[model samples]
Target: MKLVLVRHGETASNVRMVLDSLPPGPPLTDLGHEQANVLADALADEPVVAVCASTAVRAQQTAAPVAARHGMAVRVVEGVQEIFCGDLEGRSDREAYGVFVKTASEWADGRLDLTLPGGENGRQVVDRCLAAIERITEGVTGGTVVLVSHGGAIRLAGQALAPNVTASLAAGGLLPNTGRVVLERDGAGWRCTAWSGVDIVVD
Candidate 1:
């Protein structure tokens, strides 16, 4: 089975770099809507059987066009939403971003104990995301699944679930709006084949 985990399109909060990870987050900006349309077009050739999104409004909106293109409904899957910002909920300052980056980087390096103040630990975030993906895969086999999720949760889960993923690749770069991380799974386990368009080196 293959999983195409996608980051939702841009939002007003994204433009301002605010840490808006809560549910019912802001809707897509004009450019975001265009990006979603482009994403839908890009995946037109894929054998997309199921389209899932987090509880967030932005994620659902981003999945709408893709699901419509495949003649499927966007399944609202829990546990795949953004990492809660906690203390840095709405701040866009360098300090806030620094804390976020440091904590997420630690998680990528296998330091699951480290956590953002008032936010979830790496273990909690990764576990839930992985479980959600597991649930999706149980129902769909040998087919492509599209999951619209947030950048933080996507990166964390990608690194944790895919042994081929390097800490640098997982934490070094940003997952732009509508970016994708592709994964493949078999009896052996799950492997990350691509990150944001860059092909990963499977070990």
Candidate 2:
């Protein structure tokens, strides 16, 4: 199975750099909508059979035009939402973002046991995201499936599921709005083929 995990488009919270992880979150800005349409156009040639999205309104909004282009509805699946910010929810200060980045770095460094302060652990985040993917791919035997999700969750899940996802790539930075992390799942395991448009070379 081929999975394309896409980060949701920009929102006011994204521009403000706030940790808005909860559901029904901010809608996309005009630029974000344009980005989504561009994303749809970009994938027009792919064998896209289904589209899925997290519960976030931004994600659903991003998936809408893509699914519409494919003549399908966006499947809102559970467990693929953004990394919960918990106590840091809605915070935009540097300190808050600093803590989030530190925790993300720890996860990328293989510290899956460490919990984000007042938030989920790396293991929890990865597990749920993987489960969501499994659910989305169930009964699907072929073509590409797009999972519209958040940056933090996609990074964690990609790092956890793909052996080709290097620590540097996993920890590098937040995926830009509508950015994609493409993976292929086979009998062996999952392997990342691309991250944010850069192809991943297997070691």
Please report the candidate that would top TM-score against the real structure.
1
The lDDT of each candidate is: 0.92, 0.90
TM-score of each: 0.97, 0.96
lDDT of 1 by residue, 1-203 (tens): 88999999999999998999899899999999999999999888899989999999999999999999999999999999899889989999999999999999998888988878998889999989999988888866678999999999999988888888889988985799999999998465789988999998876
lDDT (Cα, tens digit) per residue for candidate 2, span 1-203: 79999999989998888899889898999999999999999888889989999999999999999999989999999999998888899999999989999899989999988876788888999999999998888887889999999999999999888887878889995699999999987565789989999888866
Judging by lDDT against the true structure, name the best candidate.
1
Provide the lDDT at 48 for model 2. Answer: 93
